[model samples]
Target: MGFKPSNKSLLLEEILDALGQLTESLSWEIGTTNLDNQTEFRALELLWWLDTSNYWTTLYDTINIGTSYSQETIQHFFWDLTHLISRYLGLEISHYTAHPEKVAEVFWPILTNHSEPIEIRTSALNMLMMSQPTVSRFLTLYWFMQAEPSQQMYNFYYTTINSMANSKYPCYDKYRKIAAQIVRFVQHKWHHWSTGNYLLDYEEPMRGYGGIVQAILMANQRTGFPSVLRLTLVRQVV
Candidate 1:
């Protein structure tokens, strides 16, 4: 080698070059002069490599807070990188179940925040529901129940609850407990109606009442059932 740069100098140079390259790479615009489609593809290639390589820690570290990047830059790259990683892995939101901490740190925020894409949020919630003890699934239902109702989310939570309550995996006793929890939780969260009305509001308050009643009925249809849940029908008095 006639003249080679030192490893230290090369590494420093590479870090700065990566920052600039990644920034341009994230955008969709492709210029014919300096940057083209090839440039953008190359940037993604670099990101894929770094994500799989040993230097990923260094790569994320370089972009996260307290680094040389500006707050705006850090936030932009952080979200873009997160979305990129999530997409790379088959949109498998349940993958985070292995890292439960990530459910709160990552998926929960996306699921609860209305600003995120609906598909992404729904997928995240669906995966979360898949990884459960009936209690955890109930909690997930509680969280989504608290959100402004969307038909899709409403249906998803209902279907998930029904499946869990009806499934034989939880045993009769455990299943009863889950159904009781659902009834109690639904009643407490939505106690604005009479004891025997069964109307579907089609709007917010009584929207999911049918599902809750169904759960209660299913729960009581068992041997040795304990005390019945006395929740009122959330129908509007006409």
Candidate 2:
């Protein structure tokens, strides 16, 4: 048989070649636990420092003043990183849950905050909320209450769930459990989110926001292939 690549010697030239390949791999879609496991929290600490290093700075300088990576690249990176998280969830969720900050901060805020795309935001929130007990229910309710929700949004969410009902992934069950917890948790806080000083008119919340909860719950139990986790919302919650 021909020689295998990994079996090659680690001489000075060989070592450098290996590192070159490794660096190239990091930019591509690859699964890695070293950043989260072996290094523990220190890994991200260093990554943040690197994100600001001369490398990214040089890259930042190269881009046009108003240019940004295309939406496809951004989405690809998101999906790749998400798959890494899913692989580690069984091993790290409990630990990451206890120490939320253990997760890389650079990505956490983007995922938790509502400023980003709903799909991305929802995914991160789902993961983070899954570990936070009943607290997330009220939190989502709080944000939901404060925001000016739309009728179109309500239909969109309901439609998302109805669509998921036909899914085949086991993770869907896990999603449903999470959605149910949020709903039950928010039942007591629901009335507080409405306006007490409205003068003219107000829309019924059940007809608006209430439908979203139902749809989200249903979508959670909708299953899919292991590679494509049904964590569109969880990725947002990350």
Candidate 3:
């Protein structure tokens, strides 16, 4: 006999069906009044997916291009749903206080705890990354500092710097500043080594170090220019 579907499987099918329908009709106005609970849940699921996809530019474009839906309304609804989901999963915002040190203290353990389900930990990590940018920057630099010096460490440092440099958000300035600080800290750590050699290693993966070179040229770039660097890197890679 063919296997019977479990209740969980049935619900998942329903959610997926709902998502397919919603994505097809982006021009439709979204509100709780029109959507039943199941459809709403599925939409939130899709939003969470987009949130973690690391394609901030795509997210911005998809939500703003004459979709006829209220961007603020959709954001508010998504945040509200995410908050509920986090609470249900026992990953409440209240659990991580505003104290920068305390926030990292709580979040890092949860993120690195291999015993927890990956989805839950990822959800928690993304939530922290998006909501607590400053703290996230601190954590990224702090961890990099503590980590062993290696090619992988250098790659991560570049990745973070590049992302901050090319970010399109209004707070890209802040992100660039953070990236600059991290870069300086790293430079100081290896001050005895040749900066030129480090830049060569940085441009190795990208086949050229245009952005890295530019960052070096602009004295003010040290304060906040990784976002620009990241943007340049992405353009060149693309």
Candidate 4:
């Protein structure tokens, strides 16, 4: 009378379906839904089990349901599930010392997938960037820079580069190269705004420029590329 692996897999699938149904039955509001604490706890419990049991591949498949499900319920459930998983990863990533690379492998697609909600993507990005291992953080930043750029990509790039500039992350030399590439990309995208006039048309343009300038100066210090910042300043002065 032993509990078989097949039985365990079936039970896991049933649990997931039950959770999905519970999510569907709830109101389809993003922030305004009155979800119970018990539901969140149950989801977290399941995530913990999946991680500890080496079922992360299964969990990855579940989260990446893709855009095929036209039902609003399924879409919202997956979004909520992704957010919960990101939280769980942030809190429990240290426990994954033996398989940090695996964690990255599972979540990188979710982070880079434009179809995913920005909040979910941001959560995944933050979790990976803040993981205890420097390699995970570095790889996360590297992979993100290589991904297709979006309007929000500038903010992410600036934030990551700024953080690396200010921290003693032990990989500054490597990050310096990445930061240089980011500066070039940002410059190319927003070069039209160099005069600071076009930036005035957007909300919080000063804050955005301030971040870019900070990143430029930091990059200058590391790579002796003061001309980039000087060129930016010159453009502003002209």
Candidate 5:
């Protein structure tokens, strides 16, 4: 059948059904298949009920439900579903006048959790970094120590720092100004990444200074990496 807007009450009912099904699917041998279609459909249905009282609650229920949560899946959900969810949030902000902070509550945690897959955490890191100052220094340090940071990880951290520096925080220059303390924190703590796509050959990685703008600016000063920063960074955030 063709698409038709459900009555508000009916919409709520449909959303509930979908949420139940998604949660059920995630818990079983079913969810791993057709994720693309499932997430797109899931996101669309959620937005249709944005004004309903449990709009965020329903979404959170899906995320927090203990039976099926994992960093890899959560990360996949973001990369797969952020387009839908972020747009939904954007619509809520513009049309529904929803609060960004409410959205951030859910968004930041998923990104900062190093235990989660790198892609999702990277996406979340960029999301919070672009819209707010919510990166977890501890998480960043933890990941850097674990293994090589991906292009995704490097860009997210670097851009986050740069954006903060250019913003109201004038003390951003003080980030790396602490001598090599910050550098050592990253070098000693973070996994030494080998991908030429994310890191520059400069004295330190873009994240070394604490913001991405500084990273890009310094990056501009040298041929640090050949990949497009926006392609590497913004799509994940936006």
Candidate 6:
């Protein structure tokens, strides 16, 4: 006996719901690292296969539909969902597709939207920067300069600059001067505090400062500067 259409649809829904639950569980269990067993790796491999086999069509469709949602809650949900997916995928969506420009088209609005949370904007910005580093270079630099000085923003800034520093592309050369200016601005603006030893003792703030120094040194090396010269420059700035 053949199954009815509604029965088949219900069965498919159950299967999808099960897959969603499995995905969520694996995400919480594995996170971005610490794969302790073969089972976890196999589960991740399966999910990766599914996402690639569909060429991220499900993700693209979800973003397209979610973008049209007028409710704030629904929009926020999509933002978080996309952010998680982006984190899990690691590589930019363009790497998995032929038409890479389309990746930028979808993410640009999210990155440019001021109302979006900084975290969401940064995620979108990272994806765009990875997909088209040269095209987005100026915008990324602009974002670093314009964004309010905070640990979160600084962390994102460090991530962007560090990636550019390590890249084989020459995009980091022209921006070296701008990067130096940004470092100086950040130091003068944010580190002009009177409290010295007390504030320096805080682990989080110190880590942030370390990140800034590391990023500056990397950027300096990209400019063909010697390590000693870079360290001296970092000392002067940081």
Highest TM-score: give the candidate number.
5
40-155 per-residue lDDT for model 1 (tens digits): 33333344433323343444455542234443344344444443443454323333344454334445556677765444455455545544335765575576576645544444
The TM-score obtained by model 3 is 0.29
Q: How far is candidate 6 from the true structure (C-alpha RMSD, Å)?
A: 14.4
Better of 2 and 6 by TM-score: 6
Tens digits of per-residue lDDT for model 3 on 65-153? 42344343334333335434533343234333334444454455555554543333433344344344684556564574455353322
lDDT of 6 at 67: 34
The models' CA-based lDDT, in order, is 0.42, 0.34, 0.40, 0.44, 0.42, 0.40
Off by over 4 Å in 1: 1-95, 131-137, 143-147, 167-238
lDDT of 1 at 89: 44
Query: Model 6 reaches what TM-score against the true structure?
Result: 0.38
> What does the lDDT come to for candidate 1?
0.42
Q: Give candidate 6's whole-model lDDT.
A: 0.40
* TM-scores for all predictions: 0.40, 0.31, 0.29, 0.42, 0.47, 0.38
Writing each residue's lDDT as its tens digit, candidate 6 over 1-238 gives: 1223345445444434433443444432255434322323332333333334454554344334423332332234334344234445443444434444554555667666766555555555555544444435545555544664443434455545444544332323454444444444333333311111110111234444322222111112123222221111121111
Clashing pairs in 6: none
CA shift of 52, model 1, Å: 7.9
| C-alpha lDDT (0 to 100) for residue 111 of candidate 2 | 51
Model 3: how far is 55 from its true place, Å?
Answer: 25
